[model samples]
Target: MTIIDYFTQLGSNPYFGAGFGLFGVGAAAALARKGMQVGMILFRRHYMMTLEVPCRDKSYQWLLQWITQHARHTQHLSVETSFQQHETGRVKTSFDFIPSVGVHFFTYRGTWIRVERNREQHTLDLHMGVPWETVTLTALGRDKGIYFSLLEEARSLALEREEGKTVMYTAVGSEWRQFGHPRQRRPLGSVILDDGLGQRILADVRDFIANPKWYTDRGIPYRRGYLLHGPPGCGKSSFITALAGELQYSICVLNLSERGLSDDRLNHLMSLVPQQSIVLLEDIDAAFLSREDTAGVKAAYEGLSRVTFSGLLNMLDGVASAEARILFMTTNYLERQVLALPLSWASDPFEHCSYYVCLCDNFI
Candidate 1:
């Protein structure tokens, strides 16, 4: 072939076309994710609080002002203290509202804690229920997490919890530890994957993102697992691309051989993932093996006690993760290690080759 002809033909080469196509897919995926960001703000929860703060009077005016001022500006906190039954002896009050995020107690253990409602039992024990939710609108500032500080200030005004006195603040469910991600998910690009199985995989991924309640509505954690298995040509890697695109989640690709990661490193990597994205663990079966086990020898699996298990649990069942993200695992084995399993990871998907795609080179 003449150099000129060879160069011209090379420009049209399938490999080159595929490479360019992959690039296009990558760009399209990035843009699609950008479009999805607008939806993140919708995830932000509306926080509400109802407690008996001293009325807007001089005695309790300082606390009331602090709470009202802070609540008016806080991103994940809100408050409403009504003038309930008043007594010349002391103040006692109640309220009704839901907080979707978490509660921050200033007295001690200032960390944010999710408010899980046990409807059957506590229906009469508490004053009000706070509903916490997820939201992505740029939460204003560090100082913006004002509810906790406000409580601290308000508590200072009250003497102590006594029969004659009233409670200044009673936290509802859903508290905010911080306005951010828990595990930083490293940016691992989309995987090479199979077509037919890839199609099914992408569909599940889309379902995961668009209607996460479909999983959570069943009372299960909002995480879904997938197992990708096939002979070399079936496109397990490329399928990840379509899946990432379909889900609008970031891809954090992990190598199983780099399995020696410390729990903190893995947590650090996972904490970077934003609200809606995928944390991809590829060749996960091989990753479970310990280094002492040489080639062809496998490591005897331990339960979730290992650092690996801790990391997996942190990523998979970590209370820190937002409800909307997806965690995906790819493996050649349709494997299930029931003996070492935890109830939290029951939704793991198995890799099966029953699904097939007809490619350009094969006509069936």
Candidate 2:
């Protein structure tokens, strides 16, 4: 039989023809998919503008907060709830919804924006102990200025949300992370310090911050340290928190007794403290007894903390220490054995008197 006649006979068979039809359909579908992918690549390259915010970036939270407040078309959602208890025995509950791991769409200034929230299951943020995530904002047009405007707006909203609030931060690994939602600012009057002591300390801090130029001209380190020593429950910590609120400054709480905290890490952390923040070291006596006893107590305290007395001293006044910084060290005991080292380091030591009194009409 001729070749044409053999092909004609095979076409007449139902199973062969069916198989051949299915093969052609598969090939066509694959070609279409490839073409579509190429088209999308071209579109994204030429027409789309994108801004990617990683989970580690400060802008990540701003963008997420903006999306939660402004994005109207988000379908997939993640909820964050916070509870606060008032002194009057009332509890306040709040719920916030953000875009989940998916694509969402919203409009801004007559422009359609696409947000893609992605989480990498296999990757983890070592510092935060959470999965890695990224939020990509894509717009149809290639105007970079629009993206900048969007980001600025998001930042403004975040600032407004945190207005009149005191943000608390803590050391995570070698970096500082926000501890929780910003707390309402406590009035300095609420803290009852003896004989205008709160006002005196507040004025001193304000003067130090305001006279940076004087410090620079005088070749001073532009740093200050305050020691608040008193018995427990004397409001040493409460006064510091109130002082931070008065100055509109964040608090970076540092724990010197944390395990695995090395001298190098301490130096690094001190050098890179967040702007307009007070570095607070609570219970300074518990961290280290005395500089002279470090060698004798090394074996017993080695497992609790790796930081040495010399290292602590270096971090306090070393070349690597941050400039224009304020340090607050609190302790219950100001005895020679407990605070011998810190007393020498503290520029101004304020002794807290044990008393209970409210200065403000309404105390928090």
Instruction: Point to the candidate with the largest TM-score.
Output: 2
Task: For candidate 2, write residues 286-343 as lDDT tens digits.
Answer: 6665454555444543357778777877787777777888887776656632334543
* Candidate 2 structure, TM-score to reference: 0.84
Task: Give me the runs in candidate 1 sitting further than 4 Å from their true place.
Answer: 1-196, 213-219, 231-233, 291-295, 298-307, 333-351, 354-364
User: All candidates' lDDT scores?
Assistant: 0.44, 0.80
Residue 362 alpha-carbon offset, candidate 2, angstroms: 38
Model 1 lDDT tens row, 177-242: 121112222122444333455556566556555775566567656655554555555556556545
The local distance difference test score of model 1 is 0.44
